[model samples]
Target chain A: MNELVANLGVSYGDVLLELSYLLAAVFFVVGLKFQSHPLTARKGNLWAAAGMFLAMLTTLFLHKDADGNGIALTNGIIIVFSIAVAGVLGAVIARRVKMTAMPELVSFFNATGGGASALVALIEFSNPNNSSTLVTLLGLVIGSVAFSGSLIAYGKLDGKVGDIFAKWTTYLNLFLLGIVITIIVFILAGNISYDSQKLLVYGLLVISLIYGVMFVMPIGGADMPVVISLLNSFTGIAAAMGGFIYHNQAMILGGILVGAAGTILTILMCNAMNRSLFNVIIGAFGGGGAAATHEQGTIKEISLSDASILLSYSQKVVIIPGYGLAVAQAQHICHELDTLLEEKGVEVKYAIHPVAGRMPGHMNVLLAEADVPYEKLIEMDDINPSLPNTDVVVVIGANDVVNPAAHDDPSSPIYGMPIINAHEAKNIIVMKRGMGKGYAGIENFLFFNDKTRMLFGHAKESLQKLVNEIKTL
Target chain B: MEQAFEFFYANKDAIFIIVLSVFLGIEVISNVPSVLHTPLMSGANAISGVIIIGGIILVGHADVSKVSVNLILGILAVLFGTLNVVGGFVVTDRMLEMFKKKK
Candidate 1:
């Protein structure tokens, strides 16, 4: 029956594999598309994930042996166990990690992917029967470079290496890279024997690792997010090379898509940081003289009830939550404020920056838990346009993401990275217990913006008071 | 019928790897944001680096008739693999250091 199915120009396995790939691709496209806008982004992600699951299941079933038994059952069991262990580790980290460290964790994961693909290629190459053609060598070299490069990027992102290394490592790396390439070319020209070629490959990998280390050493902590995106592109390219060597259409296509998407993101991140990709690579001029210290001037503190009353009267209110909101677990309170505003026919939306709340999507998950309608969550780009229309931008424990220094002060640590334009709103209301610097340890200029008002107290307490005032009014 | 089955056996490994990687990739995409992609990629790269182990195993059992070039290449691949593993650990350890509590 299976043979008949295979011959009738209706190979069920191909149909299933193609369908799975199609679905995964669809999901990838949709999810990535929605990532730019927070409104429908969560649903977009769920859709993408559903597609991926379909792909996984279909592909698994298609890999059956002639007797319809699954191939490598023992290997499959081992894989499941490894995945379980990894899952536990990931969950533990997610639960325990603060919002701030989320980016570094993401960087860690990107490094892992690059390393995995490189290792896979290496294993394949070790087989004597495998062809040692240019294609195989290309795959091996590219994958190795990406693996080491991404690991170094992860290290730098974690702040294990100082920003100064990013400053001076570029030229030295370029010099070494030149030597590695020269040796590789000489071997390829048959000027060296087979042993020499092997030595050259090792030399290439060593140079690549050193290059990776030097590449990321100089970048400032502030620019880590962009670096993560760039490294992600490298991983995708390495995977594609593996795909090429293996002659898998799905791997090649999927890898190509990821590589392209990652590259675009890297460019966008670079633009956001206001630095050319070249400059970021060289780790030019990280930190110092950029952020101005505000005068320890009189800070007027408003009560929660007064703040709530002020918020209710506004035609439009934009809630900006920061790390403090995450620390206080005030997402639910913020959600309540949104509901009350909606009941009063007031327009309410939450403005979120990419790096807002410590992790990549910390604010999204927190707000999602509070049952905040996904559509009401606004990303930096969308919120920037709406800030002018907004009557009140109610900042809940936010600081760095809203700092105007990104635009006005080139000397600040966050000079070029994209930020939420909450300062552009008609009125800015900040809720905090006291004046403290943001993650970058800099005072916020938005706090002193002419239209800004500081409401001093715990974020949840303040929001609850505001909710009460709205209820009464 | 037996010959048809033999063809399947001959091509099974290639088919298996292709099917597995694609499926795993889809699962990864569906369940998580690309944020975790880095670690996954790095892990895979590390696995590919295991070619060095394969090389060592092959070299240990290699017959005298085998090309000396293969042996040299095998040694080089092993060296690269070791460097990749060590470098990966160094970098990852440095990154994990960020989570340490500051005095």
Candidate 2:
């Protein structure tokens, strides 16, 4: 009886930690599967979050030091304070920030996350205790990359900086990276004492931070989604390093899972945008000049009432939505317009490019929320064919995705990325604030087309006005 | 049946928390927009900030010999990952609110 009891005495905490990890993994799988369809996305998110929490809890409870204490009292205090500060700050921001600043707020948070990681690495190197060559090297690479990369993404998303830095910026980064590498080599050469090693590590940490900043500084606003994914991957890798440092199985497994998932997501986002990861990086490398915004002075314009008249007579219609839809919070109104058009016996379908909004499938979610039927939400492949059959394509605050670079200009920033081909439709009606360049800072050829008519205004107001005109008709 | 019951008795805390968190997380994410993938991810990138505090605690408490360096480095890693999580959550929430109709 005692032998059986002893066999089972292997402590419940370890078993629980492993079990929690399993649950977390399950949640990750479910969350990822639900990403393509909005109907299941929220559930998917919750699953992923649950998984993360499980992983975090496992780490919290399972960690044991040499003295047999579960976690030091100081460690517990730190955790409490960190949670309190972060939770309060998060709540305040959530309560106070306007919908218009939501995207910027999100970007800022991402940057802060990256900065925290890099700072952690710095503190580790600064410490007199727990020095290992392998752990230091891992922290150096992952922490630095995540920190600078996230900041640049934040800057681009906020329009604080443009993608594409000065021509020499790339070279400068290369030079800085080289110095850090050489220093690492020197430390590993076995000639340096402990104090010297600390200095070298500190120097490298500074360079790593700069590298992270430089990496993101040049990426254009349009590619922020991909950059975010890439940074997420870096953070995961950094966490994995932390796991290795602490010899924590849960952290290692969780970090690796996050890293792998983030890498896959970044690739998918890049593919959807029809651009290579290399191009995204180079695009971020800004050249010194006037911003690369597309502003054509010569496009013909039309009134909403005239737009309504044209739509009233058109045989078929395609509706294209972009960030402006989200900004204007006009998705429901847009859906209303679509319904009215369909009622008039004009066939209507929504055209969605993969990278249409700030996120991968943004337009679909916003439209779905507005009660647009699932079948009406057409992907790039499905909608392009219908564009030629359509008599009118009403573009609501979309720019880069409608630009003709996919068909005509090879040198353009958004070239080769799949677009909605609204230009091929008999008539185009674009509702926008003005002829401002999109996230890519390039001109759209669709605006210059004879069939294209700019219905200049905020998407919601303009859409409301169009709805009124349609009702009158 | 005895082993199963015994396992449940021994690991009740772990099982309960895991199950409950999974249920809660699933419920919250079910309503958020799929487009939030990007912003959530970016926000997660921000959560990496937590690693910094983790590093500080780890290093500050570590023995001044072998693990000290590792703790400090670990803290950095935690910082980055934490930042990502915090930021990711913030963005996810913001993106979800976008679906909410304007007042």
Candidate 3:
């Protein structure tokens, strides 16, 4: 096979490799374009996977170093075996992960990619023939930061980690960041002796890892989506550095694309909450301060039968869902109620707050799993105008998004944050396990409004009872 | 310092590709609806797995004579990169599969 390939000319093999990489790049672009719409999203994923397969196959078979040596047989076996085992492990974990756990899973995957890139940089830096120290250092530092940072994000999302939430953490983070930059500059200045280069590189790696941890330590849980997005961008840039190291167009394009996607998401999440990225990074929001001390008003309870009757008689009803709905795993039952209400001549729609649930568009995915109609899921801005005309607004396992304090209570932490106008509707019925405070631990002033009626129960049970009552009516 | 400039001069094409890709990426992804955010993110995450190609190249050239640093790191890189690629795509497909129009 080697003799045949040499007979075919080394330049021909290089041409084949480059052409395959170009084709893979095209596939990625088309796949990303297709992902913008729901109907083609799954097909888009397959297309991108095909591209990945082609790139990996071509690299494994045709890759040649500057001396024209193909991969040794033993090394090839190692590569194939590692890929096969890791691929199976990855596919199994992804298939088994619950939809509610998707955010953390994404974080975990991002960390792996970052780790791979960082390792690549580490190996290259130790190579005798390495030329681009700057690119290698960058890939090493950025990839290390992304890897450790994402793991912390995963731990936080899994409820295994707690926020530090101290004033000094911010200054500490900044100080560490300054040190990282200073070290990078010092190494690049070339004043350090060659004997200490290895030590400096390892030191940079350690400091970057520490910086990554501190960077994420103080951020509250509510800002996780943004942090995840930002770290994802870091991984992408780090991968691009690998591309720069090897002069690989596929890696370059792929890295930039992911970097852009993560940036867009980060900005979108920030806009959804009416908060700046700086504010989110500084960890000043969603800390659950003294907002709960003020007495609001008397609470009114509503019976299941009355709730059913209210739904049955309403001309139009809007459902506001939150992380609570996800926790109770009530999305399917919630959908059942929506279907039942629609059959009773009541128009039903779901109002989705951008920051609702745990991640960006988290509630939509949950409802989609329950097979809710796509058209019925209205965005917060679009649904707010129609809310005043809505006859009934049912708040299910949700609080802060509809708390009204976001709009009226300037003293509230969530004051300027956008919320679904569930308070504006004629009648409000809130389903909850109890009068417990929301994830942010802020008091929901909507509960005290005259139009509001509390229906206390686990979300799934309450939704089931409401469905049954409506059926009987 | 001279070496840095030489590096840029040698890889100008790669730099151009990076710049153009950034704009194209922003353009293609800007209009994705909120409903598809999770899937879109996961899909992009999978694409970052393109680093797997780098891992393969490294592993292919590694000195495998008795557990060298190159061989170990190369194998680990391939493993992690493959995991990111396969897991990211599979999970994304799972999410998108749930997003069917009401039947």
Candidate 4:
């Protein structure tokens, strides 16, 4: 293998490898462009995967060492074996992971990518001839933070972690951030001798890891999508540092793309909640607080037969879905009820809030999984206007997005946030097991509206029973 | 100041690529509808797995004959990077598969 690669010559291999990287970058850009619409999204993903496959295959065969020689057979075997095992493991896990758990799975994958980048920097910095200290250190710090922060996010999303929202947590996070920046400056100041540089690097790594944990410690569940997006950007920039260190064009382009995408998403999530990104970072939102204790009006209960009749008779109905819908795994049943209503000559559409579920667009994915037509799923802005004229609005396992408090109550924690205007509809039916605050831990005033009727039960059961009732009606 | 200029001059091409790619990324992603947000995110996450190439380079250059830090870290990097790349793309494809037009 070595002789064959040696015959090919270093310049030829390097040129071919660089060309492959360029082709891979093209695939990624085209792939991302294809993602703008649902029709091209799956094909776009395949293009990006092909780009990844080509880049990896080229690297495996054409990669040259400092001496301009192909990789040793032993090292090649190690790379192939590790990649094969990890690739199979990743595919199996991804294939079997539940759709509702997609957010945590994304966070878990982001963590591994960050960990890999950090390890790359660590290994490079250990090299005696390494000259790019600043780039390496930046990669180390950013990668470590992304690695640890993403892990905490995964834990939070998986219900394995709890929020620690204390006033002191904010202070503690800021203090650790200060230490991390200060230490980085000290290390780069040239005041430290070479003998102690490794110690300082290790110290920086540990502090950054701690900072990552503290950064995410106080963020409530509702605000997690923003935090995850922000950390995702961090991982991208960290990978870009690796690109800078190695002068790798493919890494630079791919990293910048992800960094920009994550930044846009973070801002979008913050905007959807009508909150500033700074406030989200300071952990000022979500979780139960003084605001949640405000007094509420009496709830009215509606029978399944009445709810069924209301839906069956309505000219137009909009179903607002939230994280609760995903929790009950009732998407299929929900779809069935909607399909039945459509058959009855009643118009049915789903209104999706930007941050409706655990992650951005989570509700859309769940509904799409149930084979809901792409056109039937409407964005909040698009659906809000028609919501008023719609004869019936069914609040299915959703709360925060429909809460009237976001519009009318200034003192409310969710005030100034845009809502679906469900109160404006002529009839409202809310499906829930009991009167519980939303993930943001705020009482929903929409439940008390004159037109609203609470239908208490698990989402799947309620939807199933409703479907059966509608059939009888 | 001179040192900064020298560094910039040496890496100007890379800097150019980074600037253009950032704008391109923002332009392309800004238009994505909310319906495709999850899949788009997962797709970008997979692209970040390009760091797997970096891992491959590290591993290829590592000395396999000895129990050294380079070998251990290099192998781990490859393993994690591969997981991120393969898993990210596969999961994204799975999500996108569900999004279909009305029959």
Candidate 5:
């Protein structure tokens, strides 16, 4: 079938190929537009998939030479088999990855992206005709870093890796990066022998992999969202480098889109954490959120029934969700409580910190899964002003986001971070497993505030109890 | 195997688009509301999977010298690019599908 199609396609292959690729790019744009809203997201994805399929098909059947011959039989077979297997694996992973593990899964995907782009650069460099040494090196180095960095990110998120990077690790990382640059400059200057160039490529790949791992090791957990975004952008830029090597328009455009978006995301997340892009890259903010010297504080407990009453009669209530919410899978019951309160003529809203949860947008996705209205899910800036007027604030599974030290204590690691003003509310109800510190590893001064009341238990169980008690009220 | 300068000269327009699109992408995706950030990231990454086309073209280019190194690298590129495109779009779809607007 493919042979027949290729034979027929050879007649007007350029037009067919270019037109199909153009259509696919259009679909990608439309699909992205669709993804912005709940109503159109699924269909948008389908459109994008259709685009990818069409692009793949054109390359497979219509790509031909001056003599009208097709791709090498062995190469064609290998491509088909690999795609078939990858499609199956992708489908399985898409189905199997839990909501809580999305961040790690994303990192895993990013690793593949980075690794793949680097491979393309390697092959292009090997081809004597493709002598774009600069472009190849950019793709090779950035892609390798993204690959290894993402793996470490996955390990960190999954808790399989621990932070052991010390102050000297930074100096070593800089030194290694200097070495990578020196090798690239030599190759670009054509100072290396042809035989040794290949060896240098291998050496470069290894050093980049080490650099990537060292990068994330000492960075605080509070800055993970930023690191993840930065690495994601690296993958995009790397793809563009490969595209430059291949002179492929679609790859270039697609890479540019992702690289740009990821850059913006990294910036926004860094701003949310009150850190500069420079600070994040230098990674001097070490400790991985390890425990700090904590101040003593008195704990005040609130009864389930009292919590229900306080929530039931409140004029306005805001729920601040953190990683613990997703960790305990409390989003569903939390939404149930949201509705239960809203049904009683109490206004309810969700205050979402950008860096909340395990990854970017983690709480929003979980809450949206629970059928929370988009309007009720508010950003920190939009929600903080109303926080002072909120009659009751229910903080579920969240910690550093609501910690007042971000604003009040300059000595705190996360001192300058923007947080929800949960403490400003007339009543504050904190649902936690214990008095455990948040990811920032600092005592939540809000926990010791006069208005704060701790309702301790698993987030899911506690929210369920709140639902049950609210029904009685 | 055109040298770097010739390749740049020929695809100046393409390079220009790449640089321009970087800014455009950032502006368009600036505020994707946190709820959609993950899906959008996945979606954006899916777009990068267009590198699959590059992989396919590189290995399958009619002018490609069937050197063993080129063949092996091409195969690896195909595998990685396919995995990225397939996994990225599927995961993004799965994430988007899970969003149920409040009743």
Candidate 6:
């Protein structure tokens, strides 16, 4: 019976399964296209979920093995149980994670994607299919690295681990890469027996894991977005390798999309920070203290009443938020303050830098959590030209992004990086906790500019104070 | 080992499809606005979570009802893949839910 099914090469159930996968792939493409905009994004998500459900149900009920035996009844139950448990856990966590912790959650989830792909390659290789050996090995290497790298990124984002930059660490990572490649070449030679080959493969996995951890250990928090993006690309490519190994078309389609997206995102991240992919890979910048060289300006302070009056009467106000806003959990109050200012007829908008907060668009999500209108949020370039004509610019807990030194001061480590142009406004009021440098570890000259007044305090407390004062005025 | 290359060579159509899909993927995601980049990343993570299919096939076709290395690994793959897909889509939806157009 199995031989007969094989000879037919197009069983009815198999043909139906293939069509379902094709439908699922089409849904994925359309879903991604919808996700590019705010209006249809929710429907797009549901469409993709439907596709996933369709593919999963078909696989569970209709899939047959090379021997043509249906899924073992007990294994089917176990598979369902595992999926249920994981889906519930994921849904609960996703619901529970705050906007402030989105970066950590994203990093952790990317790790799981990488880990799953790696496990697939590992299990398949344990059985030693000769024809798919190369792709399996390739998947194992990339997936293992992405898994470890993403975990390290999560740790750094959560502040659980600190940078461990040593000149030798970079060399150590490169050395491990060399060993990984050498083992791949040896395995491809096929001189070793199966048992010994398993040991060699395990060796490769361990080294790849080590290299991944080391690869991320040297970079500081500010560089995390690019690292996360690059690792995302790695996971995508790794999953694609699994698809190739198993002849899975859905995996192939999904993996390539993610790979392309991740790669593009990484490039965009580098461009946003005015850095090269090579420079970023070299693990340079983001020392957190690398920019603390000069202290050549007098402190300028703003009184609470004066700050409130200034904002309440301003014709236009642009607010710039940063990682500091997240640290203070002040997004809600900030939005409230913006609302209050608007009621008084002050035209208010937010200038969002791409690298603001921890991840790409991290600040936007944070502000959105506070129910800020999407139109009030403006990109850096779109808002910069408007800044000079603006009456006042209020900067909240943001530092490096609003620094003027990036355009001048060649000696500054952040030179050539684009900033918020907060200096261009008629009045620049900066709200912060203290006279600390930003993530790049450099002092912001904009604070010393004659047009700037520093209103130093906790971001939430300061915004709350300003909001109260605005009502009184 | 040479046969592995031969197998890949025989699947030329799959290769062509994969390569073409790669370009399509890049083109589609290349212009995702910076604001949606995080959701895009999370959403794509969910899509790649389709590797769960690969895991399902692996454990399902193990040819036995008893415990084996394959069984354990397949279960683990299912768990991770499900978490990725579910967590990714749920979080993306959660984020998108908060976005409202200006009144």
Instruction: Find the candidate with the highest TM-score and give its number.
Output: 6
- The true-versus-predicted C-alpha distance at residue A402 of model 4, in Å, is 1.2
Residue A473 in candidate 3, Cα distance off native in Å: 4.1
Instruction: Compose the digit string of candidate 1's lDDT tens values, residues A1-473.
Output: 88887787666775666666666655645644443343343444445445444544454445443234442444344333433454455445544554334456556555555555555555455454555344455555555566565566556655566556632466787887787677556755666666766667667667766666666666666566667666665666565555555444444544555555555555554554456878767655444455445443445566666777777778898888877897788888889889888887889888877555644455665676567766777777877987898899988888877888877776687776678898889988888878887756666788877788898888888778778877887
Interface RMSD of 1: 11.3
lDDT agreement with native, every candidate? 0.58, 0.64, 0.88, 0.87, 0.81, 0.85
Off by over 4 Å in 1: A1-102, A132-166, A193-196, A284-309, A312-315, A322-333, A336-347, A353-362, A379-391, A397-421, A424-426, A431-445, A455-473, B1-103
> lDDT (0-100) at residue A282 of candidate 5?
70
- Scored against the true structure, residue A442 in model 1 reaches a CA lDDT of 65
lDDT tens digits, residues B48-97, model 2? 33243344446345554454556545444444444455445555655544
Of 2 and 4, the candidate ahead on DockQ is 4
Q: Taking the tens digit of each residue's C-alpha lDDT, what string does model 5 give over A1-473?
A: 56776776645676678788778767777777677666777787788788889988888888764456677777677678878988788778877988778888877888888888888887777777675778899899998998899889888888888776577988998899999998898787787688898898889989999999988888765566678788888898898888787666666767777788888878877777787898876764533342345555789999999999999999999999988888888888898998899899999999998878877777777777777887788999899998889899989888888988788776778887888989999999999999877766667889988899999999999889889999987
- Considering the two chains of model 3, state its CAPRI-style docking category: high
The sequence of per-residue lDDT tens digits that candidate 4 reaches over residues A1-473 is 66766776646678789999899989999998898777898899999899989989999999886777788898899999999999999999999999999999999999998898899998888776566777889899899999999999999989999998889988887898888888777877878787687888888889889988988888887677788888888888888888887778888998888999889978877888888999888866555553555566689999999999989999999998888889899999999999999999999999898888777788988888888888898888898988779999998888988988788777777888988888988899999989887866777878988889999999999899999999997
Best by DockQ: 3
Quote fnat for model 5.
0.66
| All DockQ scores | 0.05, 0.14, 0.82, 0.80, 0.56, 0.72
Q: Which of the two candidates, 3 or 5, achieves a greater TM-score against the reference? A: 3
What is the Cα-based lDDT of residue B34 in candidate 3?
76
Tens-digit lDDT string for candidate 3 (A316-427):
9999999889878899999999988888889999999887878877889889888998889999989999999999999998888898888877778878888999999999
lDDT of 2 by residue, A92-200 (tens): 6655765444545555665555555555555555554544455657666676677667667766766777756687888887887788789877876759787887777
Q: Which candidate order results from sorting by DockQ in descending order?
A: 3, 4, 6, 5, 2, 1
Q: Which pairs clash in the backbone of model 5?
A: A129-B1, A130-B1
lDDT of 6 by residue, A1-473 (tens): 66776798758788778889889888888888788776887778778877888888888888887667677788798889999999999999999988898888988988998999999998888764436787899889999999999999999989999989889988898889999999999988899898899999889889889988999998877788888888888888888887887777877887887888788888988898888888777866654443456666777999999999999989999999988998899999999999999999999999999888777788888998888988999999899999999999999988989888888777777889998899989999999899987777777888888899989999999999899998988
- Candidate 1: docking tier: incorrect
Model 6 spans > 4 angstroms off? A1-8, A128-130, A286-295, B1-8, B101-103
